[model samples]
Target: MRKRYAAQNLLFISAAVVLFAITSCKKDRTTTNNNTPVTATPTKLGLYEEAQTDNDTVYREVFITVTQIGTLTVPDSLSDQVFDTGSGGMVIDAHYILPANMITSTGFNFTGDSTVVDGITITNQKHIIQYGDDNNSTATVSGNLCYASVTIGVTNGNIVVKRLPFYMYYKSVDNNGKALPPHEFDVFGANSGYDVTFPNNAFITSPFSYFDPGTGLTKGFKMAALGTANFSDQNEVPLTPDVITLGLTADDLSSASGFSMSQLTESPPYGYQPYIPATITYNGTIVNDASILFDTGTNADNYLEDPSLNSRNAVVLPTNAAVSVSTTSGFKYAYTVGKLDNLTYVENPQYSGVPVSIFSLNFFFDNEYMLDFTDHKLGVKSN
Candidate 1:
């Protein structure tokens, strides 16, 4: 099942969860391309420096890509075969093909002349549909595409083929609740090098509304709809009705490998709540509840930002251990507490060289944690 976190209503009150705060500190010297050490003043503030009203202004965007593999043959008599992006690749439409058709049954017995070839297996199916205003205007499929192979028939003879085109709409929104113009693109296949393919004579209807670039709102369409048609009957027959519901898939955060949260025995004695047990080593010392953020967006090496604990360029350690970050976005950089750790100062310039302690997301290195927005709790576990 898919879990939804209502973060807007929940107030994050972890004093340890330091918001962006600025302080003055000394600058660090870095080596140039020729390995010559160059001293430069640090002015950029880290994310957890202090809490700012405009923090919420930053919005995160998620992109899901779906691809269709193998070949499907549909007779000219039957209507379009409806497929849905159910939760985690689960198919919701009645016309959905199941594994039984390929694994057990001889072929798929849908309306018209639709049939699965001998070697093909229906490994998975999903409907990439979404809800909300943009969704109301345009239709699309979200999530990764299904995968399968042609195990039986020849690539050419006795088979009808048509490449299905996948389409999606994109809308960029600012912090304010304002609509942005819509963008459209076809969801192409990942490795097959082709866009999409389905049976010949199959009807394709995409749920996408044309966006007015000037106003960033829907031009004319309302909510996009999905339905199957029986082309042979002359009358357009709808397969299933479209409704707003949360699609559940077997793939979820809990199912991800190497993710766990546990209680720690050794914890800080004062001003810290030990909700989850985790260990981060800095200069060979372990720190707990070090105000770690599991950001799927950070793209830098290790950096410290506490202005009150360490020298401007002084090393910032977890107080003890090693580190890891989430790989959802991209595993390009793994921020860690190196030997000469120090917090950077932002805000005032006079307090340079002052030792300060800052919070960072690099503390959760190689650990799996859960953010329970329902109960407003964060659980951490390490493997």
Candidate 2:
């Protein structure tokens, strides 16, 4: 996902707080395998009478000030302060309060200093936080507290406090028809784990690898290129024309053979139209194409949007109950349960459901992939 900003309707702390609650809470925490606690449950505190009274006083004073000053205004005097003034004097600030009884299922910890986490580096000034892909899906944020503080180097850079946003894009790979582990991404940085390389060309981004379920041969795929163009904060960006392409190759096409390199196409026949291809599967007997787009982020197991096709029988799934399938990447996707309509043998009928199963990112796991901007293709390879 990429971030977009509005010049006039700039994001502020208050707006960010509201947007955070809406977008973050909308995600069903049950889908993530990571142990990070998503939300905290409230509990009654057995505080002493004196402590309660003190808390009440503090709350009243803060509330009154907030109401009077308005949440959007920043004190001019405070804005002039420098980074060395200490953590409390930054341009923006946000507070995260965990529920009293909250317990993390998977331990959450930071491994980097304040200068960077994931891949974004925050300066001492205020920055606008935006979220989403080319589609209209997005969230905006402003203020100082958008990120967490991580300690940097010593001397003038000893303790660096950064603003950490809650959302980021995650990338993964699927070989043949299996899903692989996902790789964490920074969304806006160069070293975001995406690598593009060719055996005869200089290595760039990482590549994801896997064995084709159809042929039982090891293969690799990676990103060929990526870029952003023609989008605005007020408009919804469609997923075609300006799109991402992937490059793929395998050692061999036969289950009993060794290996080889070949070009693979994954996009739907619509040529990167509004419909997003989400999943592909080969059940030893049949292969199905399940494509769909959902609001969930990288944690989504199967984010596909398309119909299904039977590889063995060369048939398509019935159009009754949309078949929900899972990939090796642990992503779950649903294919349209309807049969192909208006069968035409013409070269290109604008849109045709040849029952050809198309696969998306939901198929790879623990493998590195690349988006080649120069060639307009995606590449994948295994570690």
Candidate 3:
């Protein structure tokens, strides 16, 4: 399940576990040239989207495309099925997906299915339904499934592997080390194509937004390095995610060729996303319990923006106070949230009572945001 937001941008998908009912699929159809997995290689993908704020300020989304225009060949049963051509759902952490509505081309919509190839099995898979806004949107899908042969070319795509052979988003395991099968949202991520993928250990963004046509800069790298790396440019600060083990799929049961998602990753494919500590201080009231996701996706700066606990509520700064955020990685940012001139709440209650703060695409301002998946740490280097 996947969704993207405007004011409260969220790149991470929440985990869900349930049973799905399988429906039969028929007819083969050709998928559009969409997210195709690349062979592992050091490929330079250009930056993605750019957004504008109320004050007319602009911010660029930081994701680098991992796929190229490629064909998606579907089975005969799904041939007449319509695939999403515009505004399909985004990948969870890194997979492409669609809701029942997006694929209604020939009046065929999303339904649970059981797919088996040469005794390899991934069954009871269903499409995701999105609810709420970015600050707190939720996805619902069932699991006990792996390896969907979607047109995206099973298990091969760049950053947002919008296809099958689903890899990420498994959240359960059995005593014998078999995956309980949570949900398969991603079938892409540095699997076969090593060339375009970042070199292991580390890679750093060029400390500039993708759309920032710098006045005097011309190195042409919005992002860089990795060994001690899941990187290309070379490194200093280490970035890694804190493993939470939301779900697990035994390596043996995961592939027909005995392929395990861990083969391409420094950690088990089940590791939770990495999060770092952030100390948020507003009006001298410091909240040391805050945590921040050092993600390459868009950020809402702080909850002080349009994304508060709920969509129906106005998320203004506390008393319009000045705010300061200090990360454990050693960067401090100061800003102030002003009263709103426009107020329109959506009655969305996804994050109704939870607190949130994010490092926006522009938050890493004048420094390098380093990610070290192997070590589970995030590093920041002053530019």
Instruction: Output the number of the TM-score-best candidate.
Output: 3
Question: Which of 2 and 3 is ahead in TM-score?
Answer: 3
Candidate 2 lDDT tens digits, 1-383: 22221222333221112111111111223323676533321111110000012322210000000100111232332111111100011122221122222212211122222244334332222223443321233443332222332221222212122322322112222223232232212221211121211122211111111112112112222321121122222222222121211112232223222221122232321111111233443222222333322211122112222233212222333334344444333434444332332111111111232222222222222233332222233223332
Candidate 3: misplaced stretches above 4 Å?
Answer: 1-43, 49-59, 66-113, 116-123, 127-270, 299-301, 304-314, 318-321, 336-356
* lDDT score for candidate 1 against the true structure: 0.23
Lowest-lDDT window of 10 residues in candidate 3? Answer: 190-199
Q: Which sections of candidate 1 miss by over 4 Å?
A: 1-259, 262-279, 286-289, 305-309, 313-369, 379-383
Of 1 and 3, the candidate ranking higher by lDDT: 3
Cα deviation of 255 in candidate 3 (Å)?
38
Error of 1 at 103 (Å): 58
Error of model 1, residue 185, in angstroms: 22
**What digit string (tens of lDDT, one per residue) describes model 3 on residues 1-383?**
01222312222222232322121132123334784432222213332223335565333322322222123232322211111101112222211232233222221232444434333233333222222234344433222323332322112221222223332122322324343332322212221111011112111111111112112222112222111122222222122222111111122122341211211123222232334457766666566756544333333334432222344654544445777767664567665554431121212234443233444434444444332222233344444
TM-score for each candidate, following the candidate numbering: 0.22, 0.21, 0.42
- For 272-333, candidate 1 gives per-residue lDDT tens digits of 12122223334433343332333211211233223334333334334223443332222212
TM-score of 2: 0.21
Candidate 3 displacement at residue 102 in angstroms: 11
